[model samples]
Target: MQQRFETIEQYLEWMGNNNFTNMTWDIEATGLLDETSIDYTASPYKIKPSYKHHCIVVEEHGGNILAFYDGPTYVFDGREYTERLPKASSMLHTEEVVTLKDYTPVEYIHLPLKEFKNYVLKRKIKRVVAHNMINFDLMSMKLVEDMDFTIGVEHRDGGLTTWSADTWMGKQVVFDDTLVISKTCNPDLFGGHSLDKLSRRAGGDTKIDFRKHLAPDVRFLDFAADMLYYCIYDVKANTAVWHWLQDHEDYQLSDRDNYIKNWLSPIQLEKKVAEIITYQEHRGFVLNVDLCEKAVKDLDAKMEERRARVEPVLPPRPATKKFMADYTPPKRQFKQNGEITSYLQKFIERIGAQLKEGDDRTMIFEGKEYKLPLPADVPLKTEMPAKIGDTTHIKQWLMGEFGWIPSEWKETDLTVDQKKIKLPMENIVAKIDRWLDVTYSTAYKEERLDGFGDYMKITPRSTRAYVRQRLIDRASKGSCKVLTNPSFTKGQEKEMCPDLERIAEQFPFAKDVIEYLTFKHRRSAILGGGMDWDEMEDGEEPEKGYLASIRQDGRIPTPADTCGAATSRMKHRKVANVPRITSLYGAELRELFGVGDGFFQIGYDFDSLEARKESAYCDQYDPTKEYCKSLMMEKPFDVHTMMAKRISEIIGRQFNRSPAKNVKYGLTK
Candidate 1:
């Protein structure tokens, strides 16, 4: 009979002697997958094992090898082997193989890169552990050899992997990774859950700097010894860390809470989340891409046309030679012989000529006097055009030449040459040096498309208007119950319908533009009508579905955190109801998330669960002993109406109106 091992050390010994399995985890790849190429229908890029060296560490016998090259190799049980490296540098050698008898038989086997996958499949290994195995090792295997390995059993509960059905090995095999597990177990070690750190924490005897051996072009013959030793040490360290976790009291307590209390282990929950996230990533929402593109193009053309109308009104050149020159006006002048010198002296003299020496020249309008500074004594040149269109040009030229211009002027109040003006500075400069400015209103016609061909960014006001229009559209049509509820507060309704007239009067042309934008924003899940094609594969259409991410704290977030809700009963900040999407989104948009082929969505809720729980708790503490009984009555009492009637009875004596009217007034109160 076999002896049962009770301790971790004894179990490890048993595993080493009889139940152990070997797996090589390190990968030599040119680079990570291009994220931009993955989206909608295409999976992330997979690395091919054949393109780089393969290192395998055998756990049972503390052996390691570097394979996939034509060099001196070993064979075990008629299988072709690759070069063997010394195990003295391995951490597992000190712990497991150092005390073995010299005459004990030890077999080292290595195969070509192409045969590695076949060997793993043939061995029927039950559990394979590695760090970051899902992204690096397993993804590389799937990409290179088209093999599918299950990570957890719950992931197979739904028909999610039906696409990979042909390549999926049976449930007898599963791959376990330590990256997420370690992070969850040791969250205080934030951002320090790398394999090296975990190995040290687990008291491993050896360490290797694996990044130093990444010479993909170098032949395996030159670095086999070091590469094999590093691989073995990594495996040993990973195993040690995993064993440490299994024996850890805190980890065990957490596992028990997750299983016994939550009915799902942390690993199971993580797998479920990964599955959902992957599905959502692959199943992107459908959009009317063609409609959006056309809308953007038409809006761009309209904006350009409007801009062209205003282009002829602007001046082709500076209004004065001073504006064209790089000269700057002096700030002040010093006094000479009790008289101010430079341009300031002439400016002050001119001001004294126009008004009393002690009083400044002022123009009074609307109960306020605006001081108009006199022009400085600067040299002037004839730079104005012979024929100008409006008074703005006269002001521009005056400002450039004399560093002074009338702060206020009307189009009808000025002459063509600005000489016959009815206000101050009427004849300050010669008519040839004055020009008119075009009087057209200067309004900005923002372009619809940006430099990248996406819609122009909108202001927060416009965003609010878009949301308001959506709510109003839904409410007016009686399509949404929440928006159209008669009892709902005015403030809540105003959030979605705040003074549309103000918006429309402010931007008359923007009404149609905003309507088009609202349609694009609400119909499609993307704002500004910009679809991220890089989220999916190059040529594939986005999948018609929604994706959500489930956090460990029991919250699931939709894209951009726009929508989310909690799963646990515990109170959380700003917890939302996930099912409210049905109420918020229109039917056409909601229908996009149809059940995929061979699968159906099952949704259930605890009907009035909170109200019942509240009633029970109240009854337990009630001195009257009637609250729970009243709640449990078959007919069910209208608590609000009953309270209203009781209040009406108390107040009806003061009123001559009918009892029904009294109750109605009470209910309103």
Candidate 2:
């Protein structure tokens, strides 16, 4: 007959009497120091280990018996003795308090760290399951020099849903994680893969709130009783969720079917992705600090030189003037004072004489009898002309009266020697135009460099601040307050400031700058842009590196979803979560990604991958027909040329003319 233990104490006593090793485990670390205060960048290995408050192990099947262990002090055969806590720190840290109102701690004989390790080694433990066991619990245990026992058991992680049981130095151990298991079962599960959430979703009543007891810095001995209970509860909850998932018939059936079809279950695929990501993270990417610093310095010098050249041409701040209130067109009273009232009235009278009675004569001012005059030459009354609808006639009248000639408007003939006519505030307007062009261009260059510099030594967060400052500086140059406003749009700039578009057309730099900014702002499905860096380590050398994060769908992506493709056919060809180095245009910029010592970069891609796939699919759907046989057989077939020829044949015309010439003629006709 087998003996059944009701409590953890009884279980420990049974373990002492007879060997029982296969178990699920969890550990609670109490009184951890704040990592923010530690200088990990300067000396990562020097950081002190966090104190472990309790370690709980529950048997996989032996009546679900649990064994609890605590540290800083342990009692052996009724004798109390001191012991050091495990060196590995818990990944999850909190400052929450532990509640003990209704909880009771089980009393059992304690084994010192050495004895505890020996007892487990002698039992020849077959499996050890825990959430985040690899990076935390087992990692901490491995740091103990005296406890050099081979982890011969299957080590499992419930958080990341990954496992490794490969032997190190002739030791064989199995590892697995439950995170991917739960995620694959239900991707849309409300709460994430946290132990508390999983247990609740599995209909278990166990709730171990780590935040309910000790402060992050509190000693483990002070809260040993409560910590032990909390640790045990976590193990029980984790095991319960695992069991629930295994017992679910629907989940088992679906998982089995998927495994049979794909040769790997969804969870297994996710595990593979996780493994890749872990390896990449461990092999951190390199940074070219010197090159980045030099680039930024050079950019700053160029910006200053550009600023000096443009500042002289920028418009001085307009004088703050006051004037008497005046009437506008249609005889409406002007609420605001201005100097243009007399000029506006004269313009209105001239328009009235050209107006016809039957023509559409809407008042410019609401509730006013004054009607806008229409040109006598107006050919049609059915459609409103641009001159009338857009109020361009008033603008023409003003230009004629003030002798103001638009800088961009040119005569139809190329032989005409244009006269430079100046009008009221013409110099100021020209200066503002110049200012806008230079400032916008400067802002664009600065933003590009600032974004790219983050990959070097500069932090992305700080670089973002610098980008904002550049915009603010540009806005301060003139009355360009719109540039600083959050809601400002490029289209609005043309409307609010009439000269912006004209300047953009006249100055190639201005047009290029705006176009470049627009291109950078547009969202794309592929990944490209500045790189992100982890904290700098002491003695770490600059080198080329890569980063990736695996999703549940087995695709890797950066935070922006910039990478990660779903198709297996092209997955190996596409480099996800990294910049497209081959497509980068500038030679100087491309040189930054040169392979470092001991590392070699290589590139290979399928030819016409999408076209090939389409062809294959078409053939598969209809075996009797060869839809793409001729094209497939033709080596190095130019699809673009083939399509262009087909289009010309269908249209019954040859497209032998330049696109620009075609467009010019098309528009003229």
Candidate 3:
């Protein structure tokens, strides 16, 4: 402790002398990490540079600590750090520290990174430990230091909400995050993976509510000491927690020393996995920005053109969206005008007049055959998508399919096409035999979909049962599809959503909507731009595809979560595959990356997560895990709070608070 580390060499030498095998580490940073970004080069660019890692503090078992900072060094004694400290969230621990009304400065030695290359090249730092190694710390090391790692499971020990594992193995390192382990491990034993929580639980100097004094563009020199203080304390806090975990021998993945010893191979694989994820997310893919922007514009225009034509004669429909203010965590039930049951019933019957019941046919999922009812021949004026798993297929086939083409199929151009090779009928009776052994199936809309429910796996003959159920759902509700199984944020969470695909089977509008959603997907994903509630509130036209997610360093961060524990199917996952969030995107919404720093902010109403989980769809969801419990027993708003929280953050609105005028006003816009 008496010897100081002004350079990485001195620290490494000191660590070697003490025979320290691993180092517990931490860091502090500033800026919009991901999702949102700042462009300093714009015309009249008044934006300040933010979004960067500040320091890396490493602590060895011998109580020796070293810190690396690219910022200026500061000299000082003890000064006031402030009395009115920001209230600590459950995740942060600051209740034990005393402060003054202002920030007190302290002297700190800066360790130059000059020797970092040698440290890594020579593998001098044989092992590294830190909280959130996968998400932040390790990721930072890879990006800034070019240090590669063999990523492992987010170390989770079933106890100490913060102790990832109730017992931290002395030889192991804490890298990944609490998030992955919480859901992947036994949910009951999982506490939480938070620095402060762990520090407090570990009975040590906890994490500082650094944000209390944190300000825009002033974190560097102005609050250098404090920022550095926070950095060092995190390392200490993490160290204490690690020791505490080490002291307690709780459950272990094996009989060996620790998780690392038992599964060293798997543990090492984690860093490599993290590396690949970082590559796609931080370094990111070179987007065809121009091509993407054009897709968004052209598709959006086409959707509008189609909607305009269908609006006039379309049957009176139920008001869409069961709840309102989709961007706010708290929800308000939307006023749904009564459904025109009579009119809908009559029209649907009118079209069904020509369709008779056909023989039952068989289809397979995972080699299991299901004999379903097939509708008899129904005249098709034009070929389009189909609506499956519905009681009104025959009618929807005619009306919902051609409702846009003729506006009113019965009154206007109901005239049949003369393309029947054999029969002298008018239009080709699209042998509404979607359930029968009909050859005209849109099930193969995809070439080979392995994730989720083997999309289009039934046959080259029938409509998808699950996708149809979701579309029929979209007709009454909005975009919410259904929860695939579980595996959302918390272990209990799950949602299902697929914008437009199989529905292109029976619905003509599906074509336009599908194309539109695809472009919108690319705009948000590849172009690094998406419209949120605030932009809509400002009446600012939605992002026509801006380079918003791109950072000053020029990369889009699209972090991926590893979900091998929940579903061995996806070794690399992004966003934890939350149905509330993932379901609404295109299945191809993979690998849209630009790296900076950001994480999915989780928010949810625990009461009725079950109900909402059954209301979404994920392309990568496992259908075998689907659960449907009392769907009737659910709140209109509880299911979508997580989704609402994400939109709130993206739009720069604090909608997660008790209630918000930001959300209320945006609803109108």
Candidate 4:
């Protein structure tokens, strides 16, 4: 390893004063593979981390070699033994607390890890620092301090959570230096925000990549020095970044009260506000379970009525069971394959479209007066599961059978008996030979069979990736033009399919489906919170994902990710189950989080938050700024109606407001 860190004596001599605990630390430890795990080779997450016999390297500002570990001793196999960790005369270090028989003992003096707890208490170490201290290191060190010691995580910040434990040290703050780096700089410099990467930024290295050093055959003590060195090297790197933030940016690592008002810069002030917002979000909003349940149930009932209304316009599900039993998939066609040919071909032929030269793959299907190409988009997928009325099956059947062009429809989650289901992507698994990667795919099946199950299942495609949009575009070929195809992005709010919306303009059935889908999506939101954790009947497991994410105080915490290392754009994290309460569509859903008995909730929304932000940047917040004139408040002129009026002039037909609205938004299509 590279010797990039200052020696123990050299660092202590130069230790400087800083508020919020100048004590930065890091640890390296051995973890036990769970007994249930079939003999190692498991994923890193599966390893049951005990952090046994570890290296906990601490660096404090007002340093005196910890002021406690000087007389520290080690306990092995229940009896006490003196530590023999190889370090400078001033530092007491030991990587393992194993018996003499287990470890290779050398003639050296070290301290017992048992002294760690006492050291913290004696020195009154209220706050400590480490990169990713919340998840791994803090828990491990606490165990060594006292095997049964517990640490409470104050807030879970994805991997960047902050933890605290009320020790004799008076509730020490295990500060994550990673968070400091994230808020202070642009992440392009060091993208992952990992300790190793951060060390590199400080003209240093992580002395040892502990992950690579711990070979299965190697004993824990085999690389003790390397682990200790790594921790020491990292603490210096961690402290260096903290010191830099203090000196250069004039930022405080401590709480809000300690921050100097005069020292705050615009960005720093924003970060300070972000910190408070993060804390507020951590506190979470109150949830009225009864109110939410009633509203969600109302949405479901409304959807059910709409489903009943949509049913009359829909065709019967294709008899996939009969097709599965009687018909065989096509023999892999020359240079291609059509496994679904026979079943869907019947519909194409029924439309009076003759096959082109006995080729089922290429034939124009006539719709009213227009003719469209057969298989206009995408090559044949190797396999289509022979399931009747599967989402893909129903959608394809609708487009093919009716010669219908879709418009303005949003993709709604399909459930089998009210639960989302996924089938194994069996064909891909069969082509394992073509895929060079075997680590996540075809690893020894019997050895890690359970892990393999995870790979076999396909993540069901959202409608944006589904085939219906292409069909909609192809069908719009004769006289009609496709508005846009459906699309889905993770953070964006717009979900309407313009193609579906435009198609629905002429087709009554399409409009019904669009409305049905909108309500269906709202209804689906309730399923994730079908049950609450508070209602668990004694020892009963309330089916996975069914339980509500409510807190003891009946609140649903939507943890905010205020400032990322790469971007300062704030977002509510882990909100997969929580619908966007701030949205106009979710107005009713938003009210479920009541103002409680005493307070009145005065709610308001920005006219165009992003647009206004940009306008602010250029000092053009004028309402007359043409781009800001339409759709977004400031008189509420409809961009959609204007587009529809222009479209009507071109097409020579009266256009309605509903489909036009979808066309203007759902721009993703």
Candidate 5:
């Protein structure tokens, strides 16, 4: 500590505010007293010896000295009681009673605990500020639950004031921010085990890291956005008050890395937290049905399986009511409403997935399946007198002796002649016990044992269908009412054709044909023209919407009639792009090829010229035409054969066979 008082007046002023002592340090009969003696000040405000050694040293500039003890009553166990003591002060402070009504329950499920602690410590903290702290405070304090406490006493006016029950110490506090005395305090005396200390209990050596465990990017401020109700301590009023911390983006707490942060962010979680508190405050604890069932079923299956493996027909009597009643199953109780059944159901489902179905047979459920072995027989004294060790040998010996029958048949088959049947997993233990009793009069042999092998060897891949079925089963059980997956049901497609027809009926001119020829095929008389459909404008129409028309009932429309008229143009212009033809075969083929001086063009010209010359003078025989009379003298041309051969060549190439190989001509050589 550092002391800085320029003048004596300044030093005295400083001394008045702080509970420090100087030259005025006095030795009262009870002990040493600092200038100002307050109740419980020594225990609550005084520094511990360990911390005093390492606490920031006070230079001449600043230091704080709490009331201290010097003379002490040495009244120990059997020691000489010779010590000085201080006389009692006439005035004493009374303890206040805290009631449940005094506290305002924390409205928000999630809180920025670190920031809350800092807020408390920012100015000053005195005695524990809790209402009905004897009970309600204790319950609320359990919410954050990572703090420690120790007993301490308060002193006032140099006398013993009051005995503080539990002083809280840590970055944790519970406050019913509404009532003045409704709060629990955790004083951070020693550091290590405070609420800030991390524990390794969750895993082998690593603590469950909230930062790694929870979703990132979430904060307490985000949770407070929808706070239901909460409380804050009014240090000035020395009272707790209630209000919602909702929508307070500015009031963010620091160091948020935990499930509490993430779990509380959702709106539903906020309601759940509050409901749980309310329920707990009303009810003590909850009953967990699922945990109870699982424990009982697991133990029963194992016991049954063990009994099924032994042999030789030793049978134990049926389980009695007294034995069954002695078994106390595990229980789990939800601390919240609307949670008990759902939680129990989920737990049951998980347990069923993990449990063995029955003795000596496998069962299939939800794709993954299980098989349970019969329990080994643990023979009671009434059933068999042989010790457990002897039973093992008895079972093996009987199995070897009964090698005449297969193991399965011997174990399960009914022997009508003998009027008996080996019962399941029980046969192994019962028969073994019987044999051991006959073979041994005393203790039997014990053998070296090895560890058990892995119990789960098969893991079924969970298919979509299996999950869907399981969900259906859960729904059938009345456990989950909502079908979370949307695909579980089919959606109906809506019809659009009716709406399209309605629009078409409103535009009447669009129903005609060839009515678009005017504007659609407009040609300039002076110059070959172009029709432009792009230059159209949209205009207002009836209540339905915008409309357009084109060519207006078969009359040619100029640019003036074309405003929105083009809509009907496309309707009647459906056949406008067809081609027209006026030429004969050779001329049409030449035009089709679009060739200049090409073979088709030349052929068309020769055919036309020869046709004209023949028609001109062929009334009987023409002197104007030279019909190639020389060709008559030459061998007659076999045009048909040539044409046939050409056709055959084309067909052969197409069919991929040889024309020459398939064709025959008489005396062609």
Candidate 6:
């Protein structure tokens, strides 16, 4: 049996078999396909045929796939083709294998100058294809001298070879049917179309090589305005051809228009061509640079002209105001004080202030008496104030609500207890400018505020500053949690806190406090600041009176009581809802007034079809009366008339002009 097995092994060995099919892996090969010695070489790439469950081996020479070895010679599932190999080899003969070949036909023609001239001299060939070749032939020959083997070539006629342009350029086409030459060709106006770019040449260098113009990422913004130039070359043969690019009329608009339109500029088009040239480095496809320059110049000129025509011209201003001698205030009528009172309340609220009730109809604010309704939350007190040393404005007092100082509040009027809360603006101006450490880090740790156990070395200012900066940066950057789906509810905010926590870590100082304060604490705090009608109407009018001072210099109202009232409301807002408070006035208290630019304007008209259709803004202070009637009714105290009359008196004193006549309407134009 040993002698018989040895004879069988010798017979199998002579069969020229090495197992390409394996026991360790699927699919191995035996030596039989070498051109030099019939030694089978393994394929460089594994191939997956559409129907086959196993990967086949494919071989290539010079980037061209030549052949693939068929499978079933190797079974992947625990079956050893190596062990079954001798039996499998019994089915194959040497004649069954076939060699693969490159099938792409060479289309370009190339020849030495002598051969090219001779061919021209003989005039045997009926036609020749060249793109602007009359002048570019010599340039093409120079390029070939530098990139010899890199240029793909195939020998067709004896001593003459054709090269495939597609092989080097990937795939390119010259569109000619859709070419147009109008102002529209000036790229800026009609871009983001099917055609990449359509530009015209005016006066400039005509020697621009166009292959240089192809961008790595094609930026054909205006299909109609850009010129898509494609060139095919067989440089050694001194031959080249070009196609005039045009738009495909039937091409559809895509969602990517916005992204691509910006790249359609004349300058961008020139850069794009250069980009393409860089991408195809080994292939010496130099575009016509002179033509590109010409196109750019022409585009610039056209753009200038378009601008000149469309540029707006301001009409000369009238030398004098146009007025009719008979002109009168439009149908003066008494406006109901009810809407005016509500409007005043809303307006004051909009300014971050509220109305407080007083004795005998006086507005009580910070223990002071005022003729106007003071902000509801302001404390009612009357006492001498704490002293501010060596100050230009004795009335100014530093308040403790985040860089907020009531400019109108007399520092002397603040009691000694209140004086402690006053932060000196001048003394700390430099420190504030330098961003000094105001946060009580060590103290906060000592106090052991809830959720701050991790803070050992961290300072209060450092943590608060970090949180403040994070909030500031987030607001400045307009960062917002994307509420992607309607199903997302408030419950998910706690879950979302982890997401904010990650963001906070990226920004030092935010810790988790900033995130908690903004997302969770904002709305609830604002609700707490809502008007407390009971407090405002509770107190009685006083002997001494205070009225809102109208500024004669066209400045916004700056009543001291109003300022005090605003500070109180802001304090409540901060305590109740920091996020909503920040939203209304930004992170810093000073920025709310300072950044908003002193003027306070709020519009609350309840007209319009949306209001009528949905009754969106409809909410009854009193619902028994008709909506229009209730809206138009005056306040029982005639607040509007009284306020307007007082304001008119102030204006007359300053400008010697009466106030504009008040007007009323029936909720229609």
Highest TM-score model number: 4
1 or 6: which has the higher lDDT? 1
Task: Give per-model CA RMSD.
Answer: 22.3, 21.1, 23.5, 17.1, 42.0, 35.9
Q: What are the per-residue Cα lDDT tens digits for candidate 4 across 1-669?
A: 111112333332344422344587665554431222111233222223433446555666545322112222332222323333332211324253222233322222233445555445444455566665433454445334432323333445687534344232345443434553444444323224556555565553343344342344234433334344445556767776555455444345343443323322333334344545543543456777777678667877776776666665554543444443333323332232534355446544444555555554554534322222223322222333422213333344445554443333222111101111211233222222222132123211122222112323322232222223332332233211211112211113434444444445444554445445445444444444322221222223322221255654555555554444233455444343334655334677656665457878776767656544544454465556544444443422545556677667876875645566545554522
Candidate 5 positional error at 115, Å = 23
Ranking by TM-score: 4, 2, 3, 1, 5, 6
- 1-669, model 5: which lDDT tens digit per residue? 223332334443554653321110111111111111112123233322211100101111123321221122111122222211111111112221211222222211121223332322332333333222322233232322333333333334665333323344542222222111111111111111111121121111111112122223221111110111111111111121111111113322122443124312321222223334333323221222333344335434543443333222333433345443322112442334423344333433543433334422342334655332212232111232222123233334333343211111001111111112113333333433442343233211111000001221111233334433443443333222210100100111111112223333432221111112121212111012232211111121111100111111211211111011111111112112112233111122112222213323233223334334434554357453333231122223222234345655765632211222123121121
Q: Candidate 1: where is the Cα deviation over 4 Å?
A: 1-19, 22-24, 28-110, 122-126, 134-136, 151-174, 183-189, 192-237, 252-269, 272-288, 291-669
TM for every model, in the order presented, reads 0.37, 0.43, 0.42, 0.45, 0.15, 0.14
Instruction: Give lDDT tens digits, candidate 1, residues 206-267.
Output: 35564343243322323343344455566667877766665666666236545334323555
lDDT of 1 at 433: 19
Steric clash count of candidate 3: 49
TM-score of 4: 0.45
Name the TM-score of candidate 1: 0.37
In order, candidate lDDTs are: 0.38, 0.38, 0.40, 0.42, 0.24, 0.24
| Tens-digit per-residue lDDT, 621-649, candidate 3 | 54543222222233323323443455678
How far off is residue 150 in model 5, in Å? Answer: 26
Question: Which number leads on lDDT?
Answer: 4
In candidate 2, residue 183 scores what lDDT? 53
